[model samples]
Target: MKKISITFLLVLISLIAQAQFTFKGTIANYSNKRILVKIDRAFDDILIGNITTNSNGSFSIPVKDNYSGIIEISLLDAKKNYIFISDNTDIDFSASITTNDEFIINIPGNQINERYQNYLNYDIKKNSILPQLQNINFYYNSKDDFYLPLKNEIQRISEMNEPDISEFPFLSYYLKTSDLIKNTEIGNGDAISNKNLILDHFKNAGQQFETSGVGKSLLYNYFKLSAMGATSQKDWENKIDKAIEVLLDEVGEETSRGQEILSATINFLNGYGLVNLTDKYMKRAESLTCEISAELKKTIQDNNSIKEGKIIPNIKFTHKLNDKYTYLYDIKTKYKLIMVWASWCSHCQQEMPYVKQFYENFKKSGGEIIALSVDYNKEDWQNAIKETSWLNDSDLIYWDSKFVKELNITGTPTLILVDQKNKILKITSKISDINNLIK
Candidate 1:
């Protein structure tokens, strides 16, 4: 019994030892003092570790069991190198910052990485011919006329390299799936026919190659393509919802990939100001059996706060000119335009004039403007106000303001429109589109 217990302990220790991995590399002409090692986790890049290079420009990063999948080694101002890492493997590579050539990888007795390096070399050679192929476009009159020759050239290159891809499953899968996506994107003729082709490619590729990074990217692109088929906003919402359903069915909801797809879809809907659809999708995501990431959960919560039809948070601020505190609810107008701006934002500087014009036209129709400055320095905020004649009622609050957190103001020049009862109506960043909302 004593001997058996000792053997079991030894085996457990060996397994644990095998789980750790190391990556060491040397950079030629390495100007950067530190190198960052990041692991690609679905839609997010997680920083696993960092290494300060020695005087000889060599660095080593020890990757724990927590990191898997694609690894990226980023050198400051230099091109990044990507590699697939597994347990117990020590991957060594030498990269040159001056050249665009592939890194010289040395993973002793790893056939997969060896083949990958060879494939990368071949791919680089193929890419070198792309400029010449693009030059073939001079013969064509228009972009529509150039598609056939370009497609033919792609087919020729794919066929010529068939032998090289025979042993590499991942590369083969990437090439075929990429070709299918390309065809779906460039397909000509009737809109219905194009839509059918896109759907067919998506359904087929998504089912067959739903396990890799490339596959996830293809599926995401498929969702974008599906959105293009919609003729109206209502149709777009329905189509996007159906696409999400199909994706959830293809890749079960209890997976990282599934959560990534849901997060991306929610972000897409949010970008277009489709608050209703975004909320619906967020609810669907939450209802799933999968573990929701904290970041994604926060995103859903923040978006819900400013979603249309939801009441705007009652925020009080002391008006800079009057030095009197005013509640947002006290703003007596049929509609309120809250413009979040900062003195440092160049985009805000450019859009201020258009916003001024919109406010002039809008205030005449029972609308009110509240120019809120998020600048940390009170003097800079005051000076910016002096430059503008249209800003009458302005407030200043640094980033620490509770209203900033409630609104989730990520960038400057954000426009939020609310009705008299403080019911959120429209939220957008495009200041020029304020006319559409007022009208």
Candidate 2:
């Protein structure tokens, strides 16, 4: 009996040692029903789990055992507002949606996240030059007047936060990139000269940041900056492909770091409607030992499905006004514009007016518009439709709808142009492309 009792105690202790951590938090004014918990896997975001939030906006997500790293908890509705988690630590915090500044995060036991919050609070308080910086288009033209002040401000912040940022790879990379941009020499000349200098600086910085292992977001920004010099979409695609090739060669495609950079590059390009380059990059990624993520695999499949001549899969939607179910294939018209969007998407909201105007012209030419909303809340979806001209023509699918998954819709305002037979003509996120299709 004594021996059995000792064994049971030992087993209990072992189980306790391997227990997973719990993360619980409350978000005020956030009506989203679900929260996505993702861990940073190289340059990709691997979905760990989804937590169902209570009606009062409180959530609890369990961190699986043996996995300890930086995790991002994002509300399904407002993905931009993410709560960063570090280590396998428990966190309980309350954040406000109305607050434009830093949201208060109260972590009792975790020093890493506490430190991060402190740094974030400090940066938010000190970032006064962002508005001024936004006004200056540094890629199109160099403003010497804007450069000095921006450079000084960045330098000042780096100096002030050196102690706090040294331990954080993401913050360290950010400071380093800002310093590099500040120190770069810009020559006064024609637009071509200015663009060349900008591209050169970004390319140089991108090469350096590619190896940093800090995070994908910084590297993505660098790639965007580097591609800004391209004169057209085709030119941009060529430039980006060349840049990727150079990067792969420099880092060695078989290396983990090289695969990380490649993965991020592929995701960035795909997000910008650059599906033409995805196949080439994806094939290169497959050659590497690193396992391709399910999300990427789905993306590759989706890209293939919507290629120029392929027949798009039918999208079934229940109309918001009458609750009548309709199929995309059933809509017989000369041309059909299937727009996947959401109420929370600022870009979608901004482009709706123009889309309406284009639809007016397009309808006259026997074109049909099917505006799909992926809003989570029924009330929000209805309100969005009521506010816009889309009330008569809109259908709601909410989040992670079958249509969204089938179409591989990542970001909103995704425009798909189809012929009478449901054959896809063009797939783009740009509003200006609608006019081209009409013409």
Candidate 3:
């Protein structure tokens, strides 16, 4: 019986191993261009990979079969339409990749549906208002249009209130997103009505699955919402501290990929400048980040990347001439100016010549310029690099790169100057007064 049990366990492991697949394809119809692709694991932004295409549009990528629930491939074409990949495998491009093309891939009945097929098919359309709710511009512009979609969705689910509906894992996710949107939008909207609805839903959702693993994850979201919803700065600070305490207490109980959520929550806390809330949690976050950094270093060893200071995450790009991959790293000089820009941003375009002029003088006086492009399109990034002769590395990367987010850069034409060791010489100096720094 013992031998049989051991054999069964071995077979289970073997089967899991065998359920792996690889995707290989070519991206063509361009003389010289870079491509960025994001392979999402179903609903969440898990297991993301950014790759560049060769000059001739030939490319290949490897993804975990289990994680590649519904692959989304977005191409950055300046004159052409974006490319999206939404299927399992075996990709072959059409003969021509031209500008006037509408290209989008749709994968129906995907893994999300497969896994949760047993649950009733809840129409995600009502919840689709999320993208708008999340859009900073839209949310600010049309707060009236920003209805409580999550609240409605949850109410629908709660109305059923069966073991299955209540037990569904996605309920917690909806609740969390709803909570975040509400808290972020609180005083900015019809305060009394919106805030009350948010608070009520927050309590209702928490009570439903208070004892589940997913509920544990919701605690972080709950505290995050509380932090953002506080009436005053003092209120916000205290709520954040309380949230940190709760997070620290429950940090150890997470299982599976819960550690990832834990790390992200900590990163959020750090970004909000609430690190002092819980020293123990701060240490845990730092330790986890260091561990993840070590693993990333091993995985990304070629680049002169290091885990020190507040360095941005390195993004991979395929060399134009040679299809080999390379990551852009911040080269420390006597003084360095880091410009965060996007091709689509007019302000960024307008600021380029001035930045270039600054570079011309600064280099002479011992300074360096590194412009990081946040263009979602790979071709646009390459095109912008060619059009603008800024004295900087041409290794254009995606905006979704962790570096941009780490720097807390939500606006374009934002600049940061650092010393030789990359210390903050200046946070963001005026474009006109930038030269004053070195002088």
Root-mean-square deviation of every model: 11.2, 9.6, 11.7
The TM-score of predicted model 2 comes to 0.60
lDDT of 1 by residue, 1-439 (tens): 9999999999998866764777777766664366667665434455555556887778877666643345666554223445553324666766665456444454422444556566665665476665567676556654676678786875676565623656555546555655655555534344446546544544444422433344445555566666776899789878877877776676555655565567766766766667787778888877766577765677677777777799988776655424443677767788888888877789988887788777677878898777777664456677888855443343333443456766877667788899889988887777766677675
lDDT per residue, candidate 2, 1-439, as tens digits? 9999999999988766765777777877665466766665545555666566788878876666644455666564433546464555576777655656344455533666666667666556356454444444354334566667666665565456524766655545544544444333233234334434434433344433433233454455445544667899788878778767766676655554555566567767676667668778877766656665554456556766866789999866655334543667777789988888887889998998888778777888988777777776566776777754432343233444567767767688898888888888888777687678775
Measured by lDDT, the strongest candidate is 1
- Rank candidates by TM-score, best first: 2, 1, 3
Give lDDT: candidate 1, residue 6: 100
Question: Residue 130, candidate 1: how far off, in angstroms?
Answer: 9.0
Estimate the TM-score of every prediction.
0.52, 0.60, 0.50
